[model samples]
Target: MRLTTIGFDADDTLWQNEQFFRVTEERFADLLTDYAESKHLKQRLLEAEMRNLKLYGFGIKGFTLSMIETALDVTAGKVPTSTIATIMEIGRELLQHPIEPLAHAAETLETLSGRYRLVLVTKGDLFDQERKLAQSGLGDFFDGVEIVSDKTVETYVRVFNRHGDGPDKSMMVGNSLKSDVIPAIRAGGWGVFVPHALTWAFEREEPPVNEPRFREVPDLGALATVLAEIEST
Candidate 1:
């Protein structure tokens, strides 16, 4: 089927995102250096994030809370209030970090905007995602926006159906194979993996082997060509 809609993942796919989180994590490790070794601290923080995902969901607020939780755990509930305040301040800074569109992001979106239905299907803190999109200067290109809590097969099916034709006639492009590619493919859409350096471990997964609908590009610069090939197939 001809591709009618294209769904793009926002963070790390179109703009710099996970890099901020990596920096914050480094600062977090430094904060708890006296309590635990850097490796142990990072492991504990990852555990806290995983455990809290159900309660906190994704985004800076949840990450801040996870840092606090990790700090308290490592310190036996004795982590100083001042350190907690510092983490909160850094988290706030992260929330306000400037949105730098990736190389070729804008041009690629613009190239495909008029020809195909473009939808921003990202998962994060709704207000923060909205703020980033507003600041990104790319929001006007999208025919629809979906700041979802998570991406799943059902999510893609519903989003593509609502915004364009349907999943079979849609393509999802993003940095994480686990969330952005695999599920979209399972929903009967084309899944294009555009990798990023700082992807969260939880979002990493081996690409589907021998999958006719799965494609991977080094960056968004090569995306238009891939789309063209997919359409021809």
Candidate 2:
């Protein structure tokens, strides 16, 4: 692989993200238990979130709205005003939560930054993503940052054109097979999947079964070793 640029997925790949969402979701379910069963509530919330994606894009604000909509739906428009207030509080707390980088995340980025053009490519609410990136302390290591609405093969091509030579010389490192890996490979780039234990269900997809440029490592700590091997051969 003759990789000259490396793109990174910000949320689960660089820091602890989905874990917070999972915690907040559990709290959301608990908050509405009196109105509906936990399993049913979860299913409803997921459905709402998926449905709202096109309308609200992606982020905490949209999630907050979805939670409110689900709460209303579950209770047939009778969910208490107090419960609505608490759900808003949940969204506020999540927005203010500290950004905790994964173990070895900074170290790995520092190691790779000097060797390649590092770009942070992630999709979400622009303001929230920008806030998290500022708080992460690893922002200085990246040559560019692309906060996109979605990750697709065309998106990868556009990002590479803006930051690097092209897709063939670029590599994407991320947690989601759907957003980060498959699309990058389809765009003619190398893709390194660093699986996170707690992935959101919507981001899950079957791995590329036999793609030569597709690679998977246990975590960010193993990335340098993988790159070194790739460079040696």
Candidate 3:
């Protein structure tokens, strides 16, 4: 319970991210409706995303590529030029979307800033993540930012060691169990799961059964209380 540094995952945890993706996905489906059913198009796009994760990593750019690839696949490489243009436009719009902080995001960060060293630990395109962080207006509340390629036990360990004393004195807070919670816990740190209403399917994972260091909160507003309880234990 002697947490000295706390890391936060950006995307859905602190800001409005997935909703934009969902919107763009819906648009993508609409653009391709003539060639494929909505359900089938969605399935193919998701498959493309999963397949391209290693090659493109994660970001709007990668997502754009996946969408285009899916379009080509579904249309048998005969997708109209206008459709491609629209998909690219969708990507540009997504990239330029405003960064909207979630409710209590700033307040929670402000509250925690005084008590613990706060760091932003997130994954995605470096430039895009940096841009969002800059736009968030929450940058000053963080002691450091780690825009990693992926979240893993080793990744958390390295980040904790570099930014704080060690994983034993660190905690990670975020919405994803796969990327944020389980990895942090496995790295010998406490993990606070703040569930988001719209999580990407790829980021979903079942919480560990009966783990004391793993906590689930309704939202970021509950984080301070959870931390206080952990501190008292």
Candidate 4:
């Protein structure tokens, strides 16, 4: 049967998300290196975020601020006023990061919208993803947008059935193996892993090496071609 619905992952999948986080983290590492190594600082920051998920939700802005707060508290007044200023500056730079769309993303979305029902299934801060969709102007391309709090097998099954004709006819495409591809595939939906060079460390994951149905595409533009083939077959 021809594919009727397609689901896409936002963030690094559609635009540059992790790159902004990485740049800010490097600046964070530089400033906190005196008090603690980058590795130590990152680990502590992860722990703090785990503790703050309910309090702050998600976003590079809040996460970076939490990292700075943790670093100062970790060192007991040794993180210094200057380092604090630098960290805030880095956070500002991060917020200012121009949301660059992935290669052929806009074109591909426009092309595919003509033929298939496309839904953007992304997990992150609600405000951030909404802002991104408004900025990219690709929001209109999707039949719907699922700003999930978390991406899991159950979520995929629910979303696919709710949005698509069924899991068998829906296709999920994104950069993350864990968040995008695996969950949807395991839910009995078709999945395409569109890899980005700068995937988030947490989002980075490997797919089953020899799954005949699983595909790894280079970018969104190629996605249109893939869909065409699927529809033909």
Q: Which candidate is the best by lDDT?
A: 3
Model 2, residue 9: C-alpha shift (Å) = 0.7
lDDT of each: 0.93, 0.93, 0.94, 0.80
lDDT per residue for candidate 3 within 1-233, as digits (tens), equals: 48899999999999989999999999999998889999999999999999999999989999999999999999999999999999999899999899999999999999989789899999999999999999999999999999998999999999999999899999999999999999999999999999999999999999975877899999899998988898898
Estimate the TM-score of every prediction: 0.98, 0.97, 0.98, 0.87
Which segments of model 2 are wrong by more than 4 Å?
A: none
**Predicted candidate 2 versus true structure: per-residue lDDT over 1-233, tens digit per residue:** 57789999999899889888889999999998888898999899999999999999888999999999999999999999999999999999888778999888999999988789999999988988999999999999999999998899999999998999999989999999999999999999999999999988899999997998889999999988878877887
True-structure RMSD, every candidate: 0.8, 1.0, 0.8, 2.4
Give a tens-digit lDDT track for model 1, residues 67-181.
9999999999999999999999999999999999999999999999899999999998999999999999999999999998889899999999999898999999999999999
lDDT value, residue 195 of candidate 3: 90
For model 1, the stretches where C-alpha displacement exceeds 4 angstroms are: none
In lDDT terms, how accurate is model 3? 0.94
Pairs with backbone N, CA or C atoms under 3 Å apart (clashes), candidate 3 = none
- Model 2 global lDDT (CA atoms, 0 to 1): 0.93
Clashing pairs in 2: none
In model 3, state the lDDT of residue 153.
100
